[model samples]
Target chain A: MEKLNKDVWVFVEQRDGKPADVSFELLSKGRKLAKNLNGNLKSVVIGHDVLALAEETFRFGAVEAIVVDHKELGHYRTMPYSRIINQLIEKEKPRVMLFGATIIGRDLAPRVASYTKSGLTADCTDLQVSDVQYLRKDYKDLLLQIRPAFGGNIIATIISPDVQTQMATVREGVMRMEPLEKHVKGKIRNIEYTPDPVDELVKLIEQHRQENKVNLKAAPIIVAGGYGMRTKANFELIRELADLLGGEVAGTRAAVDAGFINHDRQVGQTGVTVRPKLYIACAISGAIQHRAGMQEANKIIAINSDPEAPIFGVAHYGIVGDAIEIIPRFINVFKQKLR
Target chain B: MQRCVQTGALNQSIILRIKKAAMGFNSIVMVKQVPDTANISGQVMKEDGTVNRAKLPAIFNHEDRVAIELALQIKDKFGGKVTAITMGPPRASDILRECLYMGADEAYLISDRKFAGADTLATSYVLSEAIKKIGGYDFVFAGRQAIDGDTAQVGPQTAEKLHIPQITYSEEILGIKDGSVQIKRKIDGGFEVLESKLPLLVTVIKDAVSPRPFKARRVMAYKNARTLLELEKLTEGNSLLYIDQLKDDYVNKGLYIHTLTMDDLKLDESRCGVHGSPTKVHKVESVVLAGGSHEMIEPTKEGISRLIDQLLEDHILG
Candidate 1:
């Protein structure tokens, strides 16, 4: 039997030039997984002239970088991107691979997984390297993919024990991003992109990208609402409070689905993970999926009518009352104090 | 690949067809009936680490209905046929009928006990097989991900099995000109306009387009459409209505939802179901948010004022 490689590889997703925050977050998490498996942490950077970004991975504890720089690979085209990653995965045979569950990552990872015939899981919240016994078969050094399933009602630990290569797409903000204090010199392996005729099946004609106006991550305070806001009209109280307090307004997935907020303002496992200095959750039940994104805030205050709302578990201060009624009073108090 | 220079804006139905290599498009939309994950109860999961779907009510995945809407739009624009298919239990036929009500020209149910317990990979293999059996399709469509699994793997995986290019996260179909289809797809903080050759697969996002409401007339037409398995169940222990005769009658009226099984698709037994799934659920833990110490505040104005004061004292607010 061929020996399984223990190297942990993170697909460094980038657009234009700057790499995604989730890619760096995965690199930081991959560092620990690689250490547990007794191997090196490698970053696969693919984009036009993205060679410079390879060094950035080292700051996040990557020991090696595999750069596939090509003009065709500048923006993420599914065929070419997946083709390049599949070739590298087939050649390197890394034990574990991680992708940030961004649009580009979700688009590229599954195709590569199909081409490589490896087991791939999506939107994983946590990943760990552990030994596992499955179906009466002992497996050593497997990647345990932990994720919230069934709308975050349950947490399932999934493992690809039989497959040599285990891949997972992790949502952003689920993992802590910690750069190493000590920098290690990393090796750069540049792989040539051999374009194929099939790669031209899809051609990018035009692209329209606007700078995201909502910077929830950088905000010091976030006032988020949930389904309990009742109606789109009632959801305005959350926005009004946020406006009065000079903070950003966010929402749970339900609120987004209910059209109370934009997808960009959504906060949860499937949306952006934010660590504001203060998080004020209003009318949000605080499901584990939603908590996975905001529980890391410096201070949490939950306002819910349900006394047993799960959001209270993580809140520093729990207010069991109607947000619609309490928010106006809270606003009046703040207005008087600030005045 | 077909390429033709655009002639100044002319009637698309007449002039565009004259320049195009292919006259019409045939699309297959994949639909799924998933458990309502939002209304989950404590009994949602069984003891074996799998979801007790029987305990939960099933509904057509919202995004999938959006996919069907996109396909139906293509059919209306380009003079094509839309076929909706699902791989699930017999009860999944409900969604297929719903597909017909939404303007699908035909519907298929790919169900078998042998296909049970399949993960994304195994499920995609079976779907790919069924797609091949229903060949001559220019486009394959599905939702980005089903709410129940939220894996979003089956669309791309099935596309790979069909050996075609895919455009996931599609927002709208720009146009199909000179035998190539233009699509506007969503990316991080932006959108891209891409053109792909025929026989492509696209997975749609919820924001793509509002699914058309089921037409009342179409609903009246297809409300009684039943699959062969459904007919078998209806005729079970009823001597008068022979299953075969009833199926033929339904097929003649075009009210029979085509049903395919493992034997019909000739799928490899090993790769059809749970055996083909490489990923296994090792453990399922009910979400128990770790209890932490917290202060309960009164809902009165005085209590709110006191909380505000504490925030200022802690420098969380000023």
Candidate 2:
């Protein structure tokens, strides 16, 4: 397939009819990339009926949208999505394909790339266009894929050689979502795909949402407990602070392992990356892994008995008081403020 | 903070295989031979200032293979397949063949010049793609952290990229039933039992399971699976027919040397490589230690008085 098309493609991720939040985020990023490349941003929406959201996607900046609407593609199985995306690349041959580095994107991106025999940059933190490659003649692309390297210490630059259409899977909230403006013009091309069951070796088992739905990323204000919380009962301090502020409770790796909070509520390299508005950390030593997840919050308030706890380094405000004693005070102040 | 550890002693946590079982559950262990970050030599970086990756001796991350072994033990309990996925330089293929010898069905090397210096975000992006390409899986497991970087970010971030609910820092898989996965995660001091749905990504900490020793025969049989570059080297000197036959034979034999480049993922050239990265190394400096003097104190008041006087003389205290 020739890479002649001069438009940008964002995988419009949808499940059960609604678009994933990351889709809007990617569309926001893709619009900028398309503008820089002097091209149009497009959407590859797949599902039973998602053409309706095509205009909404374009309103978010897509110039053209590609819809691979089909019933077999209703539930996202690896094989069908891969087949459809793979077929779209061959037929349309867009200059770029960016996906929300979500579960489906992670599952779908590589299979499509492998089928096309191209390189894929996963979980991209930044995106841009550049003239870079290891080999001059064969491996050169005009677009640049930016990502974090060395475990978020250094930013590594990756350039695809010769593949006109490059693929990258980006994580949620790495880039801010821009609001949709006026209605944008676009066309939706529907493609047909049928993958054999023998081709799909893995069956779709049922997916269950955790009973204690603690989504760390989406939570507004987070009260994070650390090992300093000591016993399980002490964790109530974290919950009380969160409840008083109309927020959610999170934990440092220490508190979570101490059996205080669910693993989903963990904030760090092994946990969730949350950029809440307020992060109140109690007795949590600032390990790099723990810091990675919650450091992005708009404001951080550290409450540790030890004045020198590492959490103080990045906190917007620091309090050298026992979380046990201080949490009650904080709850009182929060209650008064709310009233 | 370093925890005092006895290296070879097995934690009492690992549960070995029970009676007769169908060949065990299929398990794929992910391992990375990262640079030993602890040993920073006196010599500063080179002229261009890249912290010499060559001088850094690689160590199999202590936590990652434990994740792999946990999976292997799970496969031992339930009958199934374990396939390992690694995205790195050609030398990383060394670890993939090692995964095979340890007990993986087949391993794929997702190597490309394009992926040379990717960060965790990009690295997980590439691996997620490879996992997606690999197709079938009820579970995707990774080590808690790579020691060299000490950034345990990859595993959970990869799970997020895959858009699956992840159970990280697992010390053991206590139970795996119809739809839920119950596992023991290493919290700060103890452990927590977490139950999440199927198709979840788990990052295993050290002691998640006892790592099975490398099996000698499987290692010998599968050691010849050349990475893309290695295969290219062999084909360079061979008879046209022999090279063609060898390449086709490896593919048919299922020795996955799946190679993809820029054209594969259809990534925008602008968003990948170094240029796409907005973060830059503002600076790196040596951290100094300043508390290394000797102090003598006796039980008596006179001795204590002398110590206090010395501290006062040094302006350490009033």
Candidate 3:
């Protein structure tokens, strides 16, 4: 029955001194939640010499920033990161914490939740705070966490009614970052913490950064393929069309399974969710799994041999044909016109 | 704590033999049966955003199958047993039988009418209790998330309830050495390799490995595996067949899937199902993006030219 602090906190995820855009997005959303709750919006940044990044959180909407600076925290080792974040939560007792649903966030949030014995909702698409009656008792200021379930067929809202601190990890690109307010200023609090020796059980060996890869989430235009591409070599057609259209190339899960493309390029419920302005599907059967990721695209065009392909169900434009034959002609015309 | 013994300068196979003799890692895979969302129809979605699961056909969750496959692979290499357990209605026994066909050493179905309407929190509590009851496991495996709930919280929450370390989005088991395991996990841009000690939980992603198809002979052998509830339905009102006798017969044949109720596990009724879950659905809206106003073009050269022209006009191409 301990009283928890009344503040909204956002975990600022950064790597190599660059703050992720999702951090800003969370700040924008967290600011609104803090305003509703009549509390201060705070940001927590953990890294080596990350004070500047903590200061940057204010431009996004944070009223105050907490910086935990340590060399061991630089590279996102789970144990140290979770240990520090959990310690901070235990000491500060923030009512609600928001994290970006990135890889590091997914790993760190659950571990911290476990350490603190709190509730966490992951990959949330939307979040809000409201009062509600549960078990015939009124609970005020509960975090309403909403996310697509059943493979995006349904959206479910979840809340932790009893837990002192409610936590959620929102997926990237699902929320828009607020425009920077250069005039806004925030105070920064620097804290020093040492990592436990056990936290070093998992040692960092080497990090190989992926180069020359298309990030489907940020792409405004995406040209994706499916099993209809026929072979791994035929994926070149998808790449060619993408290149001509100045878009990124993506694929269905089947295409990734067949080794037509790397798993990174796979788009679906299990892969990256994208909201491009233009999503062009070639020979994609458009299973619900695939559609869940791209249905949010502004404009969709489907070209396939089967007019009955599910991809056309959500398409803004439909062309029934063989992609092998149709793509070459389309690519040639676009190349000529753009050139 | 069990300290790993290092046999330096010993013969390699002998070292492996000693390790295997000293540590036989048993695994428990948490499985679920989810409604197939790929082929959802109008009837499958109720007016509330919640799914009318009764109207939809349920199948074994895709990632859970992969988790079982990973468990089986670990058992194949490390010399241990794989036990699959699911908490759902009696019909969830279908997936347990499928697990048997895929080479699980034992299958368990945790069912009770009181367990209905459980959210991830309640669901994980029950699953954690079941795992504790079926003790002596060094590893617990589960899919990254069930397609139906898609919360991806149960596995990690269960790990927390059990006070065990967990690895999520695991892609591969690099190796097992010195009472620890090295796992390659998928991340946003790439993958990271991390090592954790024994008695850890791992949530496997669908991209981890392609699950092997059910063996034909094993499928035939386990196709009739039934839970206790299923057995009761069969023996009810039959003068000649008694429930206990029929259960013994199936048990003797190695075709009886073990069943557990809330009382069997001594779980608190308040924390077993809907009563324990804190999440409340505020509203449900069926999201149907408008379509059908698209231009349908022919597959000819002129058609291709027109499509390109339209794309340029719309500025989607430029």
Best by DockQ: 1
Give candidate 2 misplaced runs (Cα > 4 Å). Answer: A1-4, A130-144, A195-200, A205-212, A215-218, A226-236, A252-260, A267-275, A283-297, A303-314, A320-339, B1-31, B35-318
lDDT per model, in order?
0.90, 0.66, 0.83
Worst 10 residues of 2 chain B by lDDT: B287-296
lDDT (Cα, tens digit) per residue for candidate 3, span A1-339:
765577999999987677887889899999889988878899999998898899888887787888888887887777677778888989888889999887778777766776675767777777888887765889888888876666566666777887778899986666777856473688989878875775755666545445426578889999999999998888899999898788999999889878898877888755678989899999997766688788889989899998867688889889999998899988787777766
lDDT of each residue in B148-193, candidate 2, tens digit only: 6544556755665666656555677777765567776653224456
Q: For all the predictions, what are the DockQ values?
A: 0.66, 0.04, 0.34
Cα RMSD (Å) per model?
Answer: 4.0, 15.2, 5.1
User: Could you tell me how far off, in angstroms, the CA of residue A240 lies in candidate 2 after the best superposition?
Assistant: 3.1
Q: Worst ten-residue run, lDDT, model 1 chain A?
A: A108-117
TM-score of model 2's chain A? 0.79
> Candidate 1 or 3, higher lDDT?
1
Better of 1 and 2 by DockQ: 1
Q: In model 1, what is the error at residue B90, expressed in angstroms?
A: 0.8
Residue A36 lDDT in candidate 3 = 80
Candidate 1 structure quality by residue, lDDT tens digits, B1-318 = 123323334356566667444447889999999999999776776665457878999999999999999998888887778999999999999999999999999999999999887888889999999999999899999999999888888999999889999999999998987769999999898899999998899999998999999999999989999999889999989999998899999989999999999998888998878888878889888777666688999999999999999999999986
In terms of lDDT, which candidate is strongest?
Answer: 1
Candidate 2, residue A209: Cα displacement in angstroms equals: 4.7
Worst 10 residues of 3 chain B by lDDT: B1-10
**Per-model TM-score of chain B:** 0.89, 0.78, 0.85
